[model samples]
Target chain A: MSSSLAQQKADKVYRDFGLELEISNRTFFNDGIYSGQKNNYLSASIQPEYYLEWSGGEQSFKAVGFFRWDQHDNRRTHFDVRELYWQRVKGATEVSVGVKKVFWGKTESVHLVDIINQTDAVESFDGEQKLGEFMVHFSQFTKIGTFDVFVMPYFRKRVFPGREGRLRPGSEDGLVIDSRDFSFESNAEEWRPSLAFRWSHYVGVLDFGLSYFNGVGREPVINDLSTFNALYGTIQQAGLDAQLTTGAALWKVEAIYRQNEFQDILALAAGIEYTFGNVKNTGIDIGLLAEYLYDDRDNIALSGLQSDVFTGVRLAFNDTQDTQLLLGGIFDVERTTQLYFIEAERRIGSSFSGAVEARFFENVDPSEFTYVLRQDSFLQFSLTKYF
Target chain B: MKVLTITFVLLSAVVTFGAAQTPEEKGLNVAVKATKADEGFVSSVVDLKMILRNRQGQESERFLQNKTYELTEDGDKSMVVFNSPKDVKGTATLTYTHKIGSDDQWLYLPSIKRVKRISSSNKSGPFMGSEFAYEDLSSDEVEKYKYKYLQEISLNGDKVDIVEQYPVDPKSGYKKRIAHYNKDKGYRLEKVEFFDRKGEKLKTLTYSGYKQYLDKHWRADKFFMVNHQTGKETELFFNNYTFKTGLSEDDFNQNSLIRASR
Candidate 1:
């Protein structure tokens, strides 16, 4: 009995510490219309994590620290504790406390329902990067579905690019955003209490989630373009995200109804993806994607995807390197503006990987918000090493 | 005189039973016995390493951790967590293999902390660029196939039973599979040959290094699969298997997937 117990203890191995380093270089094809904008830029980021688990893996603590250095944008170069939390799981109940990031959407074209954490705008153009929010979360799993409840004590303000940043509103006629000059509709400001709930489950071929949030909005309302004045307001939002998986096709939809002090909005994004597997015995899979986005706010909406159509194609090489590529474009229905992009990535060796991305903006109308970025088409390359 | 009479009676009974059973019934009986040989293992966790080789002899390796929860009536629930090949590290996939219709699969991407429901229709495609298909690694339920017994033969000096299995699901990549079961042992699987949808020989998988766990379950520690048409190969090694680790249905859910991935 003693020998077997010792053998069991010897077989368990733990990976407690991890680190990742990423370096990127970007070049713009045409010089930006704004002054102080550089044609070339370099940036680097490091993320270190420490994780520990005990009680038969039912309880754990994790901490992740992130730091970035940018060559041009001072505001973009910053540090954050992406995730610092303690989690416990017992039976069908799970609880987590401290700062964490939560995602809640199904559509790929536009995330209309994912509003938990504030966007880290300077990190990437896709708005997928998020700043962690401090919260106490509880989850209960039942036969009907999974219920998630979140109590956020403090709100995270959205991080934007600095004056020297390429993607920000340009200084066409001395117009630049003063990110410091921001206000909240609530008296508590950044310390305002927030609450959110979500129920997600799968039934047969359909998977869906229904969520509601009452808190400070993740997206700030830009009051004036001249000074780029912004306001964070308390809002109530009800959202639904669903997906239907049928054969080689996936149908997705995300809709939300939100009420705020400024406006009441209804937005929807629906899309479908179909894949042709192993085309002609070449071991390559190609998927076609198309989505339609609509918002009642129309052109004034902060998201440029309003009243637009997005189309894309994805290719999976199914090779040993795990190579993949995506080519996509977003076309504005009311205006002549069009945005095109291509992204490709492949594993280099055991621990390193590389990616390439390029974006183009064409036929931008002056009335549109993205007019300042007309000459900001750029290509970027990034290498990441994981340890 | 009494012992000789009893032996004669037992021989006649055995011959009569063999003559009464049809090839299909015998085949199903053997398949059921092989599956039952590894039953009663409530839950298990094992580490797996997959090595992929191309026609040019270039090789790449992937490491993963797999956990399984055995359900009494329904199909098993399993999760595969990627640990190495750094880019895909912290990614995991959860699968619920049903006895009928289609299986449900979900993928958790750690980079974004998102859980996505993936279509299981592409059963024929390679898994992680390996020779094994998604269907090949799915839970083996008797309802998924129809079996017919072939002639018994000696394989490497061991008596073996060969059975032809026809897939029930139309989306399955294979039309039929020929499985070799060792008769001298506890009806353990020794090898299998897969035929593609076009009725062409596609791949061959061989298993070895059988070890009994919990005294009742048989598991193979090594698996080697070779694709005939593509000239590609994949080898899998399973290590440090622990059974009955007190895993329940909760461990196989999407919530657990996200937690385990982190």
Candidate 2:
């Protein structure tokens, strides 16, 4: 036998343990009247993972768990549990079950933060909450390509009590109906399945996926057509999601057209991000994102009220071993406003780092539609410790 | 009967004299033979733990690591991982051999969120502040060196064969290397002398503490190398050596390097 083959046989005879953790502090600033008072926050999170593989075997198992606590200005402490899951592998097939962050999209930097649901602190949909669902997923690799599919049976229920705080559109108080809330007659009501397809070639890769459900997206409610017709109808129309990545750029576009019960709406979104430079390290990344959301139930033009067109440019420097600086600005074409952010990070050692960031929100309305509506200025500094 | 006895004695003397060849020739033959025999060992995926000693010759730091190495016909490619000191753990370093030229390299820092391809062309550069240079730690196949028999030597009371080898790669920072090989242990290399680009002795690498595993393979548990001029020393401890893992080329690709721990 070859020496490498012998080495492979030897690797199957031993096992080891590994662990990692990260702690970070984040603060938010909203100077607009809608944002309430300037709030400072500190949060510490711990994520632990373990891997086990039997000797002289191809089977392996991995488990991960996370816990976090955040302290706000009101002395209120919020605790969060993130990423609890177990994965098993046998040959070319891998399976994962439980609550885990599922990432979709090929964009270098995802811009439609609202469309995607997962746990992230950097760019959450305004007033959006982390959503988790109990799911089981299977993936297989073959010479032809790689294929993956996920089945989520239950959904997370999110209810926002009326509060005086910064609120984005589509985040208003509402009672959502889904598997967690209501019982329906169809099997679709029992479980929602998301399908993803990926094809990789020597030159590039392409990925696409679609999620179909009763529309509550994990919200629970009684499926009474009469009482909850408006919301129930939207849940019936499966949404279309897809992403494409090739060469130096990646793009993702998604649309949802629902006409089920009481909900009648059409929403379309598109985002394109391009990376330029040698190996995409020290270069410019620019993205264009636009969304059109229409609500016909109320006979109101929600599209014009919620529609937004944004263009952003990011300049990355010193992206190698020592230091990194990122300067970027987002222009809101519909709102006639601009937001600029700058972040700089330096490595102190292998496990420790410090960063400072500043952000400014400005009104650039040449039309001068309304000066009072103009929003401006926010800044924050943070330090992170990775274990 | 007396004449037959004399002929047998002459034949035995000739055989004994041939076995007494210089250690240099034996060491060179062993080095060449070992590489030729292991040609099919193309790639290796392993978990490594290294203990770095301070200037006082005392263990000062420990690094837990894992990596997948691709030993190609051209050169060695590896995805190095650091899982400690929180900031650097998830980072991966990718080293690839240039198809028609020298080894090309790059590092992907997750914290910085960028892939920085190495631009430096120096092979003798220090590797991550260690005593070993980038060239020395690389996978240098037997074909890269031309060998000549040197002399016989005794180390720690064990007779060893010594040989000198000159690197064929123009980018190599060494004039030649002198190595000592043990005759009984599959002729495994025991020590090596590295010469500077200017043809001067630069460093010495010693392999000790041999252990047999699976009744078929012999491994050196401890490897210590000292810089001749700088007086700096580095020691590598191989606690686990596995074989026949059945890893494929797909497991050592670029995406695997990035999403390794995940």
Best by TM-score: 1
Q: Rate the local accuracy (lDDT) of all candidates.
A: 0.88, 0.50
Q: State the lDDT of candidate 2 residue by residue for A181-207, as single tens digits.
A: 344433564344433333322212344
Cα error of candidate 1 at position A37, Å:
0.6
Q: Note the residue pairs that clash in candidate 1.
A: none
The residue-by-residue lDDT of candidate 2 on B1-262, one tens digit each, is 9999999999877876877745545545667666554454445455555554546775423344434454645666666776554555657776665434445554565432334333324455455445566667666566667787776678777767677888876556678888787665656778889997678788898888887655545567777888777666777776556554465655544444434544
**Model 2 in CAPRI terms: which quality?**
incorrect
- Candidate 2 chain A: worst-modelled 10 consecutive residues by lDDT: A161-170
Tell me the lDDT of model 2 at A282. 16
Model 1 stretches with alpha carbons more than 4 Å out: A1-13, B1-19
C-alpha-based local distance difference test score of model 2:
0.50
| Per-candidate interface DockQ score | 0.50, 0.09
